[model samples]
Target: MDNIDRKMLEILQEDSRITIIDLAKKLNLSRPSVNERFRRLQEKGIIEGFTARISHEKIGKGTLVIIQIGNLKVVCHKFEEIVKEEKAILECHRVTGSDSYFMKAVVSSTKELEELVDRLVPYGQLNTSVVLSSPVSNRTLLPEDEFLHKN
Candidate 1:
């Protein structure tokens, strides 16, 4: 992607709902050009999809837990199956080091967390921590120009 594409991504990261006209205005390009660029970004798989950011607390899932899983008796596919069945697991990462997987989970209470842990114990060893507060929550990705330069 070029500089214009990078700029478009930066703007869209801040506000995905921006109109083609508004985006073109910001980029100082025509509406048709902006629309074509957007279509190309999607076609090239540079822009995956758009989504809303929701508050876990507002959804009655205030309690945030980080779980590190290790020592798997079952296959990776089986462990993944168990994780998929659990509604509370929001994100799961295949991590390196001592841990096999790192998971972010949201629940209603400590009781719920305990229940979730109980279900996961058979799969592997688990080290869990309840999040107090996040100083930095979800930050958007850096512009492609900045990312490329830094690397």
Candidate 2:
């Protein structure tokens, strides 16, 4: 993508609700041009679906936990079956390094967290950590992101 496309992505990542007119003004492009660019981005699969950031604590899911499941030969098809039924799990990824699977889950209380952990015991060696505070959580990516060059 070109600089203009990248800039539009950066803007959209910040606020997907921005009006076409406002976005055109920010990028110094015409409304029709900007709209076409956005349509192309979606058609090309460069832009995924937009989402709203929710406050988990306010919604009664106050506890956040990171779980690392190790000593697994594969992702284990049954793991997906079991995890899919759980709505508390926000994300689950098969990853490299010490952990075979990494998962993030949000729950209302410690009792709920324990129940979730118990159901996962048969999968692998599990290591779970409860998050107390987050200095940085979800930071949007841009063309000029420092993490992109750190490697």
Candidate 3:
């Protein structure tokens, strides 16, 4: 992707609802050109999908927890199935180091967290932390800036 594509991604990351005309104005490109570039980016899989950022607190899921699972004896697929069955697990990553998996979960209360932990105990040893506050959350990548500026 070029500089224009990078700019487009940066802008879109901030607001995916931006119109083609507005995006064109920001990039100093014609509307059709901007639209075509966006289409190409989508086709190339650089732009995966657009989604809304919701407030978990507002939705009654105020508590945020990070869980690190170690010493997993269950099959990977079985573990994945269990993870998928959980409604509270928002994100799960197959991590390196001492941990086999890292999961981000949201719940209403401490009781809910305990129940979730109890369910996961049979699969592995869990280390959990309740998120106090997020200083920086959901950061978007700017690969072009890194690639272009390297000297």
Q: What TM-score fits each model?
A: 0.92, 0.89, 0.95
- Alpha carbon lDDT of residue 24, candidate 1? 100
Give the backbone clash total of model 2. Answer: 0
Alpha-carbon shift of residue 23 in model 3 (angstroms)? 0.6
Candidate 1 local Cα displacement, residue 107, angstroms:
0.5
Q: Over 4 Å off in model 3, which ranges?
A: 146-151
Write the residue-wise lDDT of candidate 3 on 1-151 in tens digits: 7888999999999999999889999999999999899999999898999999999999999999999999998987899999999999999999899999999999999999999999999999999999999999989777756774651
The C-alpha local distance difference test score for the whole of candidate 3 amounts to: 0.93
Clashes of each: 0, 0, 0
Off by over 4 Å in 2: 73-75, 144-151
- Name the 10 consecutive residues with the lowest summed lDDT in model 2: 142-151
Tens digits of per-residue lDDT for model 1, 1-151: 6788888988998999998989999999999999999999899788999999899999999999999999987988889988998999999988889889999999999899999999999999999999999998867765556664653
C-alpha RMSD (angstroms) for model 1: 2.3
Q: Pick the candidate with the highest TM-score.
A: 3
